[model samples]
Target chain A: MATEIVFYDIPSSLPNKAWSPNTLKTRYALNYKGLAYKTVWVEYPDIESVCRQIGAAPTRNKPDGRPHFTLPMIHDPSTGATIADSAKIAAYVDATYPDRPSLMPAGTVGLHRAFEDAAHPLIGPIYPYCLPASHALLNPVSAAYFRRTREELWGKTLENLTPAGDADRVEWKKLEDGFGKMDEWIRASGEGSKYLMGDVLCYADMWMAAYLLWLKLVLPGRWGEIASWHGGRWGTLLQNLEKYETVL
Target chain B: MATEIVFYDIPSSLPNKAWSPNTLKTRYALNYKGLAYKTVWVEYPDIESVCRQIGAAPTRNKPDGRPHFTLPMIHDPSTGATIADSAKIAAYVDATYPDRPSLMPAGTVGLHRAFEDAAHPLIGPIYPYCLPASHALLNPVSAAYFRRTREELWGKTLENLTPAGDADRVEWKKLEDGFGKMDEWIRASGEGSKYLMGDVLCYADMWMAAYLLWLKLVLPGRWGEIASWHGGRWGTLLQNLEKYETVL
Candidate 1:
């Protein structure tokens, strides 16, 4: 019997697909491990219910008496475990399916560590783009979707994640700076190897590919310099994932 | 014969013992694998020369006219590979010594993913505290010897990291909020297991323990709530590192 896995999705939330680096990291792990799982497209408001059903809900009460809501929580039916936090979920999946292609390398702890370091900062800057108040400023469609999603899902105005009138340009700049750092790392390392871990795909590639896709989607023209710096491997990696785009 | 590993340390500009969760993770892997390595301590301001010896310097035009300087880079004699990122170094160590107790759990990619997520946010807040500008504010010395030792090791300022200011409070709050979320996760998950990943210690525990120690040293009273939430397991973990206190 196949193991049952359920991935909770929210279309407008970057944590939805824009958080793709992490999502794809997990997805690739599942594929590599040859695991079959179901995907549940969830509306934002319903995320809390979904969390409770999976037992990954935080043990705190929301104002509406539901568990504190977060997304990308996965429920594993076979083990009767619901894990939240993407990395934890990924680790659990990797551990349970030892026979599958490893998301991590066989014996190189340093490579694994580099992969982690590479993956961590990728998500830092993209987080603010998800908030309704924050999203509205970046693009109208996102704002409308966030507002509608907020009303439909939470029955209220989206809480201001950033205080009113506070410009996020500084944070965005830091993110850009981080991407520049990444670009340099890629140029330095990718010059000699086919992959970040050298000669093979590993967690680092999955992470960079996913985030690059997300950045391309959200920031569009802005990523050209860094994207170009990736020297085609980054684009090819994403192209390979077109089959998985529906899930993403 | 024991595998030869060399750790380059700078007294003042040392990677914050706390920031070096990956380092500790690697060190623990080394201990678990029973690998023997020598340590070379270099004084700050002259760390560029050491970085050059390994050919892992980050930029061109170092004090030694080689390139940019970064620390905690390692040279693995067994593989004849020079690696700079601490996480990568740790992963390499684990891979190099697969026969011993694994730093990574067998067949678990998710575990590694979880460890990265847990450790990523730690750098933002803890970094400022370790900088010379913030050192007096965060770590007023017991006096001459202690102060001198810290100055000699960590350097008077951070070169690679950008200087932080009051504006970073927003990020600091985010980091604090993250701990709240973690505290809740621990309380909910601690029901059946002694560690985050179940019975045995894994990278998650090591990452958290190391971050908590840094928080204790740098942030002091600020992390009391989270520290208390962790209770005895947290304290015992720090106590185990008594020998590495200075290096940390």
Candidate 2:
């Protein structure tokens, strides 16, 4: 009656072979929901080709307005569904496996979806800090591919993506400043809350924890600084979700 | 039996005598909940003195870091509780009146709260477009107080707060650009949802509608232009909540 759900992720030289925040969002969702899924690591260069081979649709358009395929995509054999995009993957699994624990509960589908959009300001600027380190953590093929694509996108070398010395401090400070605004929102969840919504750990939590996981993995040495930034709020968030960090 | 809640609002020369976006947040919340409340008009200068007289706490601090009193405060004689700040007022009412319809629902308190934080980029830039018009809409005493305090805040005269001619179009375009991001978020609320949250309207809807109401009242003619942005998305939001536009 049950079949393994295949999750497509980007492989890394790092431990557990998962370094992408986007893919981890779906990974966390599956683990949280107690769903059985196997990780299929696709290198950066092979993502589009692999997705095309699987008939997975592109999530969004690139700068030139051409369709761009992304991961955290899932192919569920139980439902015979192939869902692309992390949010869509989560939604698909949740809908397909209604008997399991829900990542997005009833009436919360839209709220958690909005959470991604709402969090863009804080999450968007984090790429520069992690980009160079991420490249270093990748295998040669994916590393070259990541560097080439990201450089073309950002129009700067990965080393120069973040300035060295005190300017880096200023950049990190700007990124750190984004946490306070988010802290206020979390605090508004009735005194002390670590999750995005109150009590129930929804997909929004996965969205956050996945990003923090990427930070923890890619910037292992400096991740503590970010986690400790907002009164240990970010750190506490990751620690609470440690149970769902299983790589399976 | 329920005693009438006293809802404090800023008075304007415009019809219905309500024009402040901040105060309208509470107004819309109270009306949407079907709470029996009477509006008590407060002139701009009297906000501090009146709030102090009624023992309502200051919502936030002013530029000098001193406590700043504001309207949209509420006095619930039934519980002898005085609540300041629109968000606080909504939460208090929801908790106090469990029998009444809820504004900020049980789990959504945080997400909707984040919605406010997330929407600031769009909503914060809108002040300049309404400031001069808001000053014109207020009574003379309040007009003088508003212009004086606002100019002091911006370090520019009310007339200089916004540019005229083609440059004004540039400014308006910048403001309009903000709506697209929000549109993407709102559109994520399932297919063609007019409210911030799908299915059940929440306080987040009040947050948006209240601001739109202020724009409608203060900038009547030009308000339609704002509503028409994002493919009449905002206009539909205000339209869906028209029943709650009652001023009692």
Candidate 3:
């Protein structure tokens, strides 16, 4: 039997639903490597129990002293290794499946990590713009859990976080500006590069592509507009990853 | 005779001086490639005149309508090409001398640019903390010009920019936090990696090493403190680049 990797993901109310940027990274890696993997759906509230059962580490400690667990964890039944955290899972998968197509090109792990680190702060301002739309897509149970937990974390209700009217435009402008900078950076790399890492897509591209997918999923209506904002560059890049789409 | 590249740099008063992170990237690239190059010192007031004489385009247009100019421009007498931006210069050099050690490996330019873009913002907050010390190390003419131009740009005097007191500590804390995040990202790349792109040093590493060198030139005392701040991992990385240090 082919080795099976059990991928964990958060499910939404919408049919054919799976959207969590972090977990999507692992999924993309698995798909890119052509590894045989089966995804196990876990709700927002069950992340802790699911991760704990698989022996995955806590992402962080919560305010109430409980360990904050996150999804995108995976179990490699063949190796009996369960890895949590998207980056960790990526590194583990890449190292174990050396002969498979590489997610991180040789000698780029650190550089890629720095790139992700740099882009991470930009992701923060986008949350306010995305959270409300994302809330609507979550299952009733997941939506309630997501709303309450995120409200406590953000110190604002979802609706209040991204209120309609001029406020939404203002928040969206911030996200657009951030992505604009990214576009400029990509262009500055000169004519040869199509993806963030150039012609061939690497883990860094996966990081971005997965996030773009998540953005499209949660805010289906606004994505086409936002994707077209940077001269349709981001949307085009997302389309480039279509070949790697694996049936879940 | 082998073609010698003309490297332009900002002048300082201190002996054995070197500054300007952008140009430092070019210098590191040349050194890594073991290329023959001669330094052409340009003071703050003379950069525009020199670059214009060399036919290098202005970096950007200023708010007041004057063409904005910056350092690290290069003159390739052999090809009669004078590139203005450090990134462009690096690309030109890496391409012209294809067999030399690459500043950027093939198919990685766009990814590297994203990495550089991500780290660029962190460099901004450190300037306020370093500008005063940097001013002290500049030559008389350069120092006076630096002070006046920077004061105008910042809308505050250098003395006021880095005030001595608890306030400085607060500013420093912010810088440290930025670097701390970088350190975390580096550690996340797994065990085998050393430089930003893993064991092999690349353009991104040069970008950082050059900045660290500037920090040392501007604030010698703080460089050691800051280098050691992140458990000396940064210091070790800087040391790793020592062999690539070319004598100008």
**Which candidate has the top score in lDDT?**
2
Q: lDDT tens string, model 2, A1-248?
A: 65898889998887689888888888888898898888889988889999898898898999899989988788888777888988877777777778988887765666666566677677766898788988998999999999999999999999889767997788777677766766777778876776766677888877877878888887788887888887898898899888888888
Question: Candidates sorted by lDDT, descending order?
Answer: 2, 3, 1
In angstroms, how far off is A97's CA in candidate 2?
2.9
Enumerate the candidates' DockQ scores in order. Answer: 0.09, 0.54, 0.60
Per-residue CA lDDT of model 3 for A1-248, tens digit only, reads 65788889888765667677787788888888888888889889888888888898888889898888888888898999988888778788889999998788777776677777777776667677667877888878888999998999989888788756887677677777877777765776667457666667788778877878888888787788877877788888888887665646
Model 1 spans with C-alpha error above 4 angstroms: A1-121, A124-145, A148-229, A246-248, B1-229, B238-248
- Retained true contacts (fraction), each candidate: 0.00, 0.55, 0.73
lDDT of candidate 2 vs native? 0.82
- Please give the C-alpha DockQ score of model 1: 0.09
Better of 1 and 3 by TM-score: 3
TM-score of 1: 0.51
List model 1 lDDT by residue over B1-248, tens digit each: 54478876533232442233434554554554567776665544555667776777463454456556655677878788877755566566666777766555543333354435444664455554444333433222222333454555556534333334764566566666655544444443335445544455555556666676656655556555445543555555566554544431
Task: Write down the RMSD of candidate 2 (Cα, Å).
Answer: 2.5
Q: What is the descending DockQ order?
A: 3, 2, 1
Q: Which ten residues in a row have the lowest lDDT in candidate 2 chain B?
A: B189-198
